[model samples]
Target: MKKLTNFTILSLFFFSGIMSSCKKDILETIPNDRVSSAIYWRTESDAIYGVNSVYSALDAVNLFVLDGVSDIGHTNTTFTVEFNIENGTYDASHSRIQTEWQNGFRGIFLANDVLANIDKITTTNTALLDRLKAETRVLRAYYYLKLTGLYGDVPLITNPITAAEGLSIARTSQADVYEFISTELAAASSALPASYPTAEKGRITKGAALALKARAHLWSGDFAQAAEAAKAVIDLNVYGLVDEYGKLFTYAMENSKEVVFDKQFLAGTLTHNSFAYMGPYSQRNSSSNFVPTKALADLYTMKNGKEITDPDAGFDPMQPYLNRDPRMRYTMYLDGDPLPSGILFKPVPGQGGADEVGKTQYNTSTGYSLKKYVVAEDLQTPGASGLNFILLRYAEVLLTYAEAKIELNQLDASVYDAINAIRTRPDVGLPELQAGLSQDELRKIVRRERTIELAFEGWRLFDIRRWKIGEQVMRGPVYGITYFENGNPVTIEVPSVTRVFDPAKHYIWPVPQKETALNPALGQNPGW
Candidate 1:
């Protein structure tokens, strides 16, 4: 698949999956030292460089077809005004989703070009032959999954077809997309290594393909199938939760048991380590993009406390975060001494204040900001710590199994044990589940556990969608306090969630304006 082509990177977008092309992207990123797509793939060395180019696309920005944007989702979670949808302040032309959409398709096309061309060329190194192809397929599948999930009914392109074919294709149903991913992942699982070589340890693995299948089935609501797929990796027994929940993402990255797949980042280099960028905007720091919302904050259950959702607990939802789930503290940036970052991010403990612009601002009105993915200790220009962005972890598979079993109404002692194993982690703050609880009770517990366990790993958006509550919860009140120092409490009312997600449209991003303006054959998503 090292063959360069006549097409640009976007040609890979619809290719086979999301990452259709690989080599062209590298040439473009390296500046004017241009390599025409039509000339390349000279030897094994060429293949190695070509594959490395493919790996280059897995950065924070490109990954946003899945992770929420740098500014909005990050800031929106905090109810911070980094990007405002209410004021029609959306930079639709430059949204990360748009970038993701374009990048994903570009990748798909590139993957197709490489995969199709590799077989045509002759190479004697049979050892690395299957390795490169296997990883490419895995990557293609990964990008397609991202695109399909974001914009339901995306065009399912399996090969690098001509411009005539590309321009006229219609959106395929999500069911078909899921089927494609399921099948591709299954095939790649066999071809891929259970783990990568030492130099290749960071690349795709058999475990990753299997885990992807598990997640795909989970999202598709194939609980029984999802459980079966997830159990395969769970049974492999190679992965388990990290001893400390907070250490899953670290400079050296200690927690690997559950991290099946991740985008590795090396600090002190020209790499994409955005812990500083995405984290809270503290006086001690710069800015916190994604904050934990009151709605999500409330997901944390209280310790030895009665249930608020229940009728007789005298539950005051106002004090939701207090005495609630331990995951709350780990997942959110709360008002405290030394937070998850451990750098003493006490932005507004007792004193409320204004910014340099003289407008009042507050640290998470719900007393919560994102702390999960923020690498707190590393703050030096090479300033932040090195950390890999975990794509899939064992904790998710465990929970997926538990949740699926619960849904199947066949949950047993093992299910509870699996869940408690995670709950028991010191990094995670919650206690064990109530013994012998009904399936319904188990359901509530799992939901709460997932909120704190996987809070900021880019799961909330999908969780809300799969749970089918995106409209209600995402459109509800994003609670916050705008404390100003006039000795008067300056409460800033956050606009409702309604502004962000339009029920009819706004699910998948609108096709990039340029694409539509050029291709008359292309149709926009329903709401667009």
Candidate 2:
């Protein structure tokens, strides 16, 4: 698959008239790079460039690091409010929360800009024009999805608006925003192709539109719509799980059949510091901002498909990391694990002949490092990781279908097949799910499958909130494993920090105070 280039992004700005100085008409303090509709959109290329800028609004770095706000991972630094969000200290003033709000609106504005002006381009190819419009609409709906998901009932700006007009628009209800997203995605999927050529691999596809539709519906608790959309993508038969479960996250096999949608990044031009944030600080000058917690590690069942709580499951506390799910090994770095860089990890660092966590402030607070999305090469090259942050994939589609079916009391052989496909993928092949389970039983199985399958991929945070399990998990002390002593692992559960999640307030993030100040009509969420 070909990577998106910075050259096109540069030309996008040029054609959009960012290079030309704009005369400030009544608008005071004109944005230096604001798009001027009167000066651009003269050709198909101009429309393409405008849409490309819309695509640029998504930041892979933000998507990945936001997982740190979830229970599976913890952020070490206080620079961002991720830790504060986790510990229940975050509010409307958090810069990260504000950035999430602003970035989504920025993308919405760019997408609307393209949609409002694409007809000005003289294109004989009606298909091209329709597809471009579909693409922009899909992207616009996506921005709305992000906005409403993060901040409930955000301002719905469907068209490019003047500065004065933007200041007065009130927040739209979440249901209305989701309704618009569903309508747009239905249109986009009809117009989009199932696949693109290698050079155009990152472009949105029919599968991506449906998959995102499934996601939007699932998030909104519309089980039937979510299941229908996900099953549609599955029936298309263009996507499947990668043979190696780990390869789904690596740069070598990017744009594989499993990847439905991803944010493309180039190694030298637009790389992320995921390794720096997620790797062990002892190796590769890692920042250790997002480290795995023992609570997450314990979520993976034993290879025999028995939970640690199961009486028959042979789980040893002394050697906690052994005989667990194969994905546990792939997704997290445990004590004494052999790293890809050819060194054995020491749990306590300096003591026990292991790498010391105290070597720098950028060390893991939980004594564990993230393995997914942080390849060995990323550690070797510092910031040269080009691994695309997968936004949607075939496994997620399958899981979404399974969850929706289970929730609707419609679990059947097809639901089993959907989950078993994910379980039986190569290298992580666990036992197939048995048939004739109760609806509640199947629901538990589906939820556990989602937790293990999508760990550290930025899904857990939303999953907990949607399932109404935030108070159950987030209002207690989080634990991590103790280091080795007397040549054996202590296996003690070291209390890290107690997290609080008020069921009423934490369920929805507060609308940024700045936003509410600018437009008082944009009322805050309850209990903010």
Which candidate wins on TM-score? 2
TM-score of each: 0.80, 0.93
> Per-residue lDDT for 32-75 in model 1, tens only?
33443444555675565555445555545233223333112324
Please tell me which predicted candidate would have the highest lDDT against the true structure: 2
- Candidate 1 RMSD computed on C-alpha atoms after optimal superposition onto the true structure: 6.5
Error of 2 at 429 (Å): 1.3
Per-model clash counts, in order, read 39, 2
Residue 323 displacement (Å), model 1: 5.1
What are the runs in model 1 whose C-alpha is more than 4 Å off? 1-32, 36-39, 59-94, 162-165, 283-285, 304-324, 339-343, 349-367, 382-385, 481-502, 506-509
Q: What is the lDDT of residue 413 in candidate 2?
A: 92
Q: How does candidate 2 fare on TM-score?
A: 0.93
| Candidate 2 structure quality by residue, lDDT tens digits, 93-179 | 988888888898888877877787789887788788888788778878888887787777888777778877867789889999999
